[model samples]
Target: MSDQDPDIWSGIEDLWAWLDSHSPGDGQQSLLLRMLKLSEEVGEVAEAVIGAMNRNPRKGASHTWEDVESELCDVVITALVALRTLTPDTREVFVRHLARVRERSLGPGPGPRPA
Candidate 1:
């Protein structure tokens, strides 16, 4: 994997590139497929979190909150990569979708919120 800036955005791009190599952007694949992949990654995060919490008795467990955090970031980046892959116009779609979600959740807040 190519080294990029350590920001969340770059991490997302890295995951996207990895996904492109792995799956090659099949338009026939359902959104559910991507979502399932994202879910699997998140499940790994849950496992790590559980390990960090000492709920699981695994050998040589050095897991910490920071470890779980990076795993969570991995899950988020994987999900975003899937979204960006499925929707090429991701920025606009994300903006529009977030607007609709925010409206639904917050009862129509101020318009055009910053990223």
Candidate 2:
């Protein structure tokens, strides 16, 4: 973790910059909107899962498991974008928060996560 080069995090930052440049609204407005978009993305994931499960008898299996997976990825991307919207140092913020969460969930001696 020594190097934080132009990788996924860089891409994440680039994505935020791109979106921010394209957006017409104010920074605060866009940040709020991004958060709402994350929620919408999450809802889409639920919808995709339901569709994959054919939960709605009326419309048997409208989505494949692959569709569900794509929707889930969208949710993650949307969430990361939202986090980026909230802070420019999203990489550090996320890493710090993730470490805290892992430490809280698993003790100090927490080893590699179960595969």
Candidate 3:
């Protein structure tokens, strides 16, 4: 992990904290709302990708690749924020889930032995 990775999580947590403070709520509704926010961000990513690719004939390259990249970053930040909202130990939860996914897809690895 890069030195800046931790800082990114810290920033996301700070943003989430600030938002939560301004709009106080907890439990099921809060979780649902956060998850819904992730979907909205994902939709924006799709829109940006389409615009970047000039897929819409009417728009005609209305957005650049940089816009797509920014939207993708938003999706990631939104996902992490949702996860943090769902659990205080967001890093641990994410690490464990990612490890499981890696193991399941790539098998146990000690320097990439053949499957």
Q: Which candidate, 1 or 3, would have the higher TM-score against the true structure?
A: 3
Give the clashing residue pairs of candidate 3, or none.
none
Candidate 1, residues 1-115, lDDT tens digits: the string is 3465565555566766676677744655745677888889888888887878878765345578898999987776767777877776666777788988988988966668799
For residues 28-58, what per-residue lDDT tens digits would candidate 2 score against the true structure? 9998899899889888888888889999898
Sort by lDDT, top down from the best: 2, 3, 1
Per-residue lDDT for 99 in model 3? 95
Candidate 1 vs candidate 2, lDDT winner: 2
lDDT of each: 0.74, 0.87, 0.86
Arranged by TM-score, best first: 2, 3, 1
For each candidate in turn, give its C-alpha RMSD to the true structure in angstroms. Answer: 5.3, 4.9, 3.6
| lDDT top scorer | 2
Tens digit of per-residue lDDT, candidate 3, span 1-115: 8765668768889988987887656667777888998899989888888888989898878888899899889898989888988889988999899999999999987876678
**Model 3 TM-score, 2 decimals:** 0.84
The local lDDT score (0 to 100) that residue 88 gets in candidate 3 is 90
